[model samples]
Target: MAKRCVPVTVRWSDMDAFGHVNNVQVLRLLEEVRVHAFEDLRDHGGPSLLESGVVVARHEVEYLAPLVWRLAPVPTDIWITAVGGASFEVGYEIYDAVDGAAGGGGGGPAAGGERTVYVRAATTCVAYDLATGAARRLSATEREVLESWTDEPVPFRRRSR
Candidate 1:
């Protein structure tokens, strides 16, 4: 699947005293991107990816570099990595959008510049029936919808190479 990228603004409050984005704020950034993804699917008149009784079961994040304030919005890429009976995994790659290099953080630094990764993360979300308060299997329609966003799996570990 093609990567879905959203531009995210960095608020003044998002910066820490150290003059960089706080570690926790990165999670908020991820949340913004995640919500945007689900809302896009929801707007298409399909099942609500978020409102239809879905809850985050796990969130794992890795901070790769410090993100300083920038006028341009940060570009975030999010996609589905895994789909299971009652849960699915959503992955995200967040990085500085500098020098018009949006979504370019995955690559090495430019010859005369630097493009840094702010975070690489994933969330496992479980589908639940609110009334029953239990996990519910994904329906065929839901699975199909989610599969549309599925992409190549992202490694959780940082490679030495």
Candidate 2:
């Protein structure tokens, strides 16, 4: 499946005293992209993962480079890394798009330009029954929708051997 490229604006407040995006704010960026992904899936005639009730079970983030405040929105690529009975993993890469490489329709970075990645991360999301307040198995429709967005896992630098 093709990765979804979402352009995320970095707010001035997201910057820390160190003059770069705060580590905590990076998670918020991932959340924003994930929410957009779910909405995009629903817009494309797929089941609404958000409406069905999903929660983040885990998040692994690697800070590769400091992201300074910029006027242009950052290009972020997000895709499904894994899917299981009740959970799925979403991988993300936040990077700088050289030239005019803005992805308007889920396409990745533009060709012929070097890009600098700021972060690589993944989130594990679990299906849940909000009515019962318990984890639930993934439905066929949900699984199908997720599988359609599947891609390779994030290549983290400090992954366990």
Candidate 3:
């Protein structure tokens, strides 16, 4: 599936005492991406991931490096990792804004510049019926729409800190 790359605004309140984005703020960024990606579904009268009945079942975030505050927006790339009967997983990669282009940093850091990965994260969300208060199976169209954004499988494993 095609990945969605978005330029996210970094507000002053998003930073911590160290001038880097706070850990919680990073999750908020991911949430923003999720909402954006699912907007189409809601627009078409389908279940809304944010306003409708979708719920975050789990979130796994791996912080690779701190992202410093910059006037330019941070580039975040998001894709669907998996789609199930009633739930789906979204994957995200937040890249350091080097070269001033969307995900433009190439190779590794050079002597004069550095390109780094700020965060790698994933979220699992389940669809639910608001009135019934129970999980709802994904409609055919819903599944198809989500599958269109699916990427290669991501292994879920822990690494030593």
User: Model 3: what TM-score?
Assistant: 0.81
After superposing candidate 3, which stretches have Cα over 4 Å from the reference? 41-47, 101-115, 154-161
Q: What lDDT does each candidate get?
A: 0.81, 0.88, 0.79
Q: Which parts of model 1 have CA positions greater than 4 angstroms off?
A: 101-115, 159-161
Stretches > 4 Å off in candidate 2: 100-113
TM-score, predicted candidate 2 vs. hidden true structure: 0.89
Screening candidate 3 with a backbone cut-off below 3 angstroms (N, C-alpha, C), the clashing residue pairs are none
Please write out the lDDT profile of model 2 over residues 1-161, one tens digit for every residue.
56989988889999999989999999998899999989999899887888889999999999999988777788899999999999999999998666543443536655776778899999999999989999999988888988988998798989755
Q: 120 in model 3: Cα distance from truth in Å?
A: 0.5
Q: TM-score for each prediction?
A: 0.82, 0.89, 0.81
Q: What lDDT is reached at residue 11 by model 3? A: 84
For residues 15-85, what per-residue lDDT tens digits would candidate 3 score against the true structure? Answer: 99888899999999888877776885566655566655788899889888888887678888888899999
lDDT of 2: 0.88
Best by lDDT: 2
Worst 10 residues of 1 by lDDT: 97-106
